[model samples]
Target: MKKQHIFQNALLTLLMLFGLAACQDREILTIENQSPAIVMDLSQEELFLDSNFPDNLALTIAWDVAKYSQPTELKYKVEASADESFEVPYVMGTVSGSQRVVSYTVGEMNKAAQTLGLTANEQGSLYFRVSSYIGEAGEYVTSTSNTTMLTITPYELEYPTFYLVGGATAAGWDAGQAIPLYKTSNMSYIYTYLTGNEPFRFLGQTNWNPLNYSIDQAGTRENYRYFKQVSSNLVQDGDENMKFTGTSGMYKISIDAATAVQSIEVEASPVAGWDFPEIYMVGSMNGWSATAPLTMAQVSPGIYEIVTPLGADAEFKFIGQKDWGDLEWGNILKDNHGYSGYVGPKGDNGNVKFVGNGGSYKVTVNLKAGTYTIVSQ
Candidate 1:
C-alpha cells in the first residue's frame, strides 16, 4: 500500500512540472515586421519670429497615437532637414511614447531657422519629421514618418562693422588709423577719449567713399552731453560731420547702424585709456617660450588679436614684450585663479586655461575692458 501511495505522489509532481513548462513557452514576445505610420500636423505652416516675442509660443506639432500589438513604450526623435531626402538632419530631441505634441517658442523656432541656414529676414522652407523606434538596442525596429514643411524667417544675429575716424579721435582723420568699435549683433561700442571742438564721423572701412555715417541732424540729446553737427571737413557731399561739445574726457560711444536707422549715443566712461604698442602670447603651444612668443597685432589702442591653433587644455598668457619682463596679463587676480574670460595686469596671475577642443581660435584682448575672449574659427 505504501509503494502505491509513493508512485501516485511521484506522478502528480511530474504532471505539475509539464504544466509550468507549457506556460513558459506561451509567454514569448513577438515584434511585428512593419511599423505603423505616424501622422503629424502643425499648428502653423508659416513662422515669422519676432525678437520682442521670444517667449511667446511659435508653433505646436501634434502626432497620431503610436500603436503596437502588445503594450510597449515607444521613443521618438525629431529631425529637421533642408531637403526632402534628409541628407543631413538636425536632431531636436527625444520624447516619450505618451507625448503626442511638441511646442516651440519664438526663440526656439528662430534658432532652428538659423540652424537650417535660412536667410535673415527672408522666407525659407524647413522640412521636419519624426523617427520612432521600438525595442531596446541591438533588437529594435525604426520607422520614419511623413515630412512636414515650415516656412520660417529668422532675424539677423550680427551687425555690420563700423570704424571711428575724425579730428576728435586719436585716428585724427587718417583712414589707416581709424579705430574699430567692438561690434555685436545689436550694436557697436567703443570706450575712448574724445576732445571738444573737433569733428568726427564713422567709416565703414579704413578708406573714404563707400559707407559713411554721420549725425542725422546738427545735434542729438543724451543727458548733459551733446554731439552737435559740424559741417566742416565733410568727406562726401552732404555727408554731415558731428563734434563733441561737452568737456574733453573719456567717453563711451555706442552706435546703432541698422539698415533702417543710424543712431549714436555718447556717455562718460570710468575706465582708463588703453595704451599698448604690441602684445605677445606665450603658452604651451610655443613650449612656454617667452623668448620666441607668438605676436598679436594691435587692432585698436589697447586691443590686440591673434589667430593660432591651440591644443586641448592649452595654457597661455599675454605680455607687452616677447620675453615677458615687464607688462603681463593672465587670469584674474584671486585666491584661486581660473578661467573667467578676464585677465589680470600682474605677471603672477594664473595661466589662462583654455576650455575647448583642439582647433584654431581667435584670441582677443581688450585691456580697456580688462577682459579677453577666445572664439573657435
Candidate 2:
C-alpha cells in the first residue's frame, strides 16, 4: 500500500506540471509592430495652367483608417480654396465609408463653379486639403495630409492653321492639316503638335526669335506673328486670318512600295534668294537619320528632283537645306509649299501634300497599296 500511494502522488505531480506548462504556453502574448498609416495621396503636388483649365486634369485620393485591433469606419472631408493658406475654403463635399480609395475631379468642380456664376478663372489658383477621421472601439482618431496647390490661368493663343492648296487628283493633304489651339487667358500655354511621317525640324521663324521661335516679337511681326486661337475660334475664321504659312522647303523621301512603284518625284521651291538646296532622305532605307547627309542634285532650279529605284517595299523622307549667308537653315519655304507623288502599277499615283508648319515638317503620306511606316528622324 505504501508503494502504490507514492506512485500515485508522482503521477499527480507530473499531471499538474504538464497543465502548468500548457497554461504558460497559452499565456504568451504576441505584439505586432504596425506600419505607419497613410491618410491620403494627392495626384499632383503643383498644378499650373496659363488661363484656361486644362482639358485633362484628374486627381485621385486614397486613404485608410487608423490601424487598430477592431473594425473602424473612416470619414473624409475635402475642401478647396482660392488661397493656398486655406483660411477660407469652399466646402467641396464630405464622404464617409469603409472605402480606401476615392477620386475628385476638376470636371465636377467646374460644374459647381458654373452653378455659382463663376466663369472658369482665366488666372486663378486653388488648393485642396483632406482630413480623415476614424472611429474605432468608441474612440475617434483623426489625421490630415499636406495640402496640394493648383493654379489656373487663361489659355494661350499663337498657333497658325495649316491649309491644303493643290496637286493631282490624288494630290491633297494626306495628313490632316489644321492644328487647333486651346483658349488661354494669358499668353502662356503648352503647345504640342504631331509631326507627320515626314522628318522635319524648326527652321527660323520670320517674326519670332530665329533660334527659339518665341513670340516676343509679335508686335513687330504684326501679320506674321501667329497667335494661339482655340479650335472653335479658328474654325469660325479662315486660314488666311491666321497669317501663318507652312515653311517653304523640299524633302526627299524613299517609298518602299509593297509592289513595284514607278514615277516617284519630289518637288519644292527655293527660299527666294537662297541657293544650292541640299536634300536629306530619312526613312528605313537610309536609317531615318535626320542629320545623315544624302546627296541631292537639282533637276531644275528651285524645283529639286531626285529619282531612285525602290524595291517592292521601302520607306523614306527627304529634307532640304539652304545656305543663308554663313548659316545653313532648313528649306522651309520649299517644303511648306511643295508636294510629293508616286505612280504605282496600273496608273495608281498618289501625291503626299503639306499640312502645316508647327515648327515640324508635316506631310500626308498617301499610298496606293500595301503598308508603310515612318522610319526615322
Candidate 3:
C-alpha cells in the first residue's frame, strides 16, 4: 500500500511539470512578431511656446494605446530635435500605463529646445516624435511615432564672470585692469597669452571682493586654490598662490569652477612683430567659415601651432587675417610621409589634407620652411 501511494505522488508531480511547459509554449506562440504603430493627431494646430512664458504654460501630448499580442509593460517617451531627421533627439518627457499622455511646462519645453541646439530668444521650428520601448537588453523592442512640428524660443542662462589678476598676470597688480577670461563650450574659462614672473590668482567678481582662486603650492600650476564666502568680512582660503616656475612664454590657462580644478599648458606665443594681427585655420572641419576660424598661437618668429582633434579626410588652410584677406597658406606639394606631410603658401593653393585614424593632434606650421607636421596624440 505504501509503494502504491509513492507511485501516485510521482505521477501527480509529472502532470504539474507538463502543465507548466504547455503554458510557456502557449505564451511564446502568442507573442506578435511585428511592432505596434503609434497613432498621432496632426490635424490640430501646430504647437507653439511663447518666449515670455519661461515656465508658466504647459503642453499636452497624447497618443493611442499601442497594441500587442503578448502582455508587455510599455514605456512611452516624447522627444524633440532641431531637425526633422531626429538623428539626435532630446527626451522631453515620459509616461507609462493607459494614460498615454505627457504634459511639458513652458520652461521644460524651452530647455528641451535649447538642448536640441536651438538658440536663445530666437523663434525656431522643431520636430517632435514619440518612442515606445519594451523590455531591456537582449529582449528589448522599440517603436517610433510619426513626426510632429513645434515652434519655440528658448532663454539663455546667466553665465559666471571671471578675471585674472595678481602679479603673475599680464596686468600685474592692477585689479581694475585684470585680464578677462573667455567662456568655452564646457563652461570653463580659457585665456591664452604671455605670462610674467609673478604669481597670479583669479577673481570671481570684477573688483575682487570675494571668490579668489590660487594654488596649493606657490609655483605649481595644478592643485588650484578655491575660496568660499564665509560672511561679510571673513573668507575661507583653499590653497596657495598659483604661479609659473619656468621661463615666460605663451600659455593656455583654463580654470574650471565646477570641479575647482585648473590646468596650465605651454603654448607658442605671437611673433614679436608679425605683419598679420592674427592667424587662424579655416578648414572643412569648421565649415570653412572665415568668420569663426580656429586661431593659431605664434610660438616663434614665423611658426604657428595649434592643438586640436583632426578628423579623417580633414583639409585646411591658414588665413593671415580674420576675414579672408588676400594672404592664405595651402599645401606646397604631396610628400611621401603622409597627408599634411608638407605645406606652404607657394605654388597652386591646395587645402592641407589630414590622413589618420582621427584623434587629437598638435599641428605646427613653419612658413619659412614651407612645411607642417601633424603630431598625433
Q: Judging by TM-score against the true structure, name the best candidate.
A: 3
TM-score to true structure, per model: 0.41, 0.25, 0.44
lDDT, candidate 2, 27-75, per-residue tens: 7744332432354576655433332443455556565554533344566
Candidate 2 regions exceeding 4 Å error are 1-40, 45-57, 68-70, 111-119, 134-141, 153-377
- Distance from true location, Cα of 159 in model 1, Å: 12
- Mark the regions of model 1 whose C-alpha exceeds 4 Å error after superposition: 1-13, 23-27, 33-37, 134-141, 157-377
Model 3 misplaced stretches (Cα beyond 4 Å): 1-10, 20-51, 119-123, 135-139, 153-180, 183-189, 192-250, 253-377
lDDT of 2 at 22: 93
What does the lDDT read for residue 316 in candidate 1? 90
How do these models rank on TM-score, best leading?
Answer: 3, 1, 2
Which structure among the candidates has the greatest lDDT?
Answer: 1
Ten-residue region with minimum lDDT total, candidate 1: 220-229
lDDT of 2 at 61: 56
Give residue 224's lDDT in candidate 2 (0 to 100). 28
User: What is the TM-score (0 to 1) of candidate 3?
Assistant: 0.44
